[model samples]
Structure formats: structure tokens, C-alpha cells
Target: MLRGSGVTTLQYTALTVLERRGGISAAQLARDSFVTPQAMADMLRALEQRELISRSPNPASRRELLVHLTEEGRRLLAEYTDAHAAIEELMLSGLSRAERAHLRSSLDGAWRALRPPR
Candidate 1:
């Protein structure tokens, strides 16, 4: 489904993380997106080639490169938002509203618990 939209799952995940966190270092993005540093570097290059993201040197840390989503990236992400919502709706169609809420809460909790401390 995502492939048809020209966005891979990893790309979508990275885009969403950037949307939520704003500009952050490539290393930080890698950690947040659950990808290795090398993988994130390659992905960032691909995103740059697509003009979906921009990277700049961090003033605070010369060694770090801050990554940010471009307007094009945000637009693509918005387009996918509706598709994701439709897919989620279909996946959760069998559950009641309350059950869905509980499931969401539990999943969120698990995610938080599993993430490494900042």
C-alpha cells in the first residue's frame, strides 16, 4: 500500500519522527527511528535526493548534522495521512471505540517503555 504511494515504511517512519520532533541530528533521528546510524545516513541521502528533507550542520555541535523535513516532505506525509487513517480504520473496524482506545493506550505505553532513555 505504501509502496504505491512512493514512500517506504522506513521513510514514512522517519518522516513522522521528523514531523513530531522538528529538526534534530541524524544520529538522534536514527535512534528515534530504530535504525542503525549507517542506515540512517543512507536513508537521509535518499531523502535529500528526493528533495523531501534537508540537512545542515548543527551550530551547537559541528560534528552533527541536523535533519529537517522540507515542505514537499510535509505535503507527502499529509497525503499519506488519509491513507494511513483509512488503513487503521479498517484494521480496527472489528473493535468498539473503547476497545480501540484501550489498545492505542496500551501500544503507546509499550512503545514508550521500549524506547531508550534520552
Candidate 2:
């Protein structure tokens, strides 16, 4: 559904992570997004080329580079938020509100269970 938005799935994943975490190192972004370091590097290069994200040396750790979303990136994400919601609504149309809530809770629990111990 977000294909025409000029953002790939991996790019969107990275953006979502940045949106939640504010700014973080590229490596950390890769880890959070569940992508290999090399794949994350390539995705970051593309995002940077699109002016959707910026990279700069981390002030706290010069050895690491911090990645952040730009205004354009945020705007794109905001635009797609409604589209995503609509898709979810359509997908869950057959389910009652309570069922949807229960499904969401179950999915959240499953995700939490799948994550490694922090």
C-alpha cells in the first residue's frame, strides 16, 4: 500500500524506528529494524539521497553516526498514517471491536515473547 509513496518497506521500517527513538546510531537502527548492517547501510544511503533522513557524527560518541528523519520524512509518514489505518480497518472489518482489541493484545504479547531478553 505504501509502495507508491517512494519509500520501500525497509526504508519505512527505519523511519518508524527513528520516529519512535528520535535519533540513534545507524547500527542501532539496523538492529532495531531487524536488518543486517550492510542492508541498513544501503537503505540509509537511499533515504539520505531522497532527503528523507540525515546523518551526522554523534556528539556523545564521535565514532558513531546518528540518523534522524527530516521534515519531508515526517510529512510522508504522517500522510501514510491514515492510509495504514484505513487498511487496518478494512482488514479487521469482519471482526468486532472487542475481537480487534483482543487480537491486538495477542499480537503484542506474541511480539514481546519473540524478542530476546534485553
Candidate 3:
């Protein structure tokens, strides 16, 4: 459903994570996007080449770099706003507001439950 936008789902997922988290390490982006670090490294290269994202040395950690969405990246995400809303509407159309909230809570709980021990 997300193809043909010049952006793969995984790329979109990484962008979304960066959007929400502001700036984060590539490894954190990988975990949040359900991808391996190697895969995220490749994706970040593509995104950077496309000018959709930028990375800079982390001030708090000299050895780490934080990835961030660029203005173009924000524009790209905004362009899909309608489609994203429509998709969510279609998926939740059958449920009441309360039920939707419950579903979100359940999903969050499941996500937390499945995470490996830190």
C-alpha cells in the first residue's frame, strides 16, 4: 500500500521514528523501526543521499551520531498526511473511540511485553 511513493515502508518507518523522537542514534532508530542496525545504516545512507535526513555527532556522546529528519523529510511526511489519515480511518472505522483507545493500549502492552530484556 505504501509503494510507488519513492519511499519504501522501512524508510518511511525510520522517518516516522525520527520525526517523533527528534534526534536519536541510528541503533535506536533501527530498534524502533524493527530493523537490524546494518539495515538502518544502509537506509540512512540512502536517506542522506536523498537529502531527507542528516546526521551529526552527538554532543553527549562523542562516539555516537544522532540522526534527524530534514525539512525535505518533514515535507515528504506531510505529503502523505492525508493517505496516512485515510489508512488509519479505514482500519479503525468499525471501532468506537473507546474501543480504539483500548486497542491502542493493548498494542502498546504487547509491544512492551515482547521486548527483550535490557
lDDT values for all models: 0.90, 0.88, 0.92
Per-candidate TM-score against the hidden true structure: 0.89, 0.83, 0.92
What lDDT is obtained when candidate 3 is compared to the true structure?
0.92
User: For each predicted model, how many residue pairs clash, with residues at least 3 apart or on different chains?
Assistant: 0, 0, 0
Better of 1 and 3 by lDDT: 3
For residues 2-114, could you state the per-residue lDDT of candidate 1 as single tens digits? 87767789988999999999689888899889899999999999999999999988899898889999999999998889888999899999999999999999998987887
Provide the global lDDT of candidate 2 against the true structure. Answer: 0.88
Model 1 regions lying over 4 Å from their true place: none
The candidate, 2 or 3, that scores higher on lDDT is 3
- For residue 38, what is the lDDT in candidate 1? 98
C-alpha lDDT of residue 30 in model 3: 88
Q: Which 10 successive residues of model 1 have the least lDDT summed?
A: 1-10
What is candidate 3's CA lDDT for residue 12? 94
Pairwise TM-score winner, candidates 1 and 2: 1
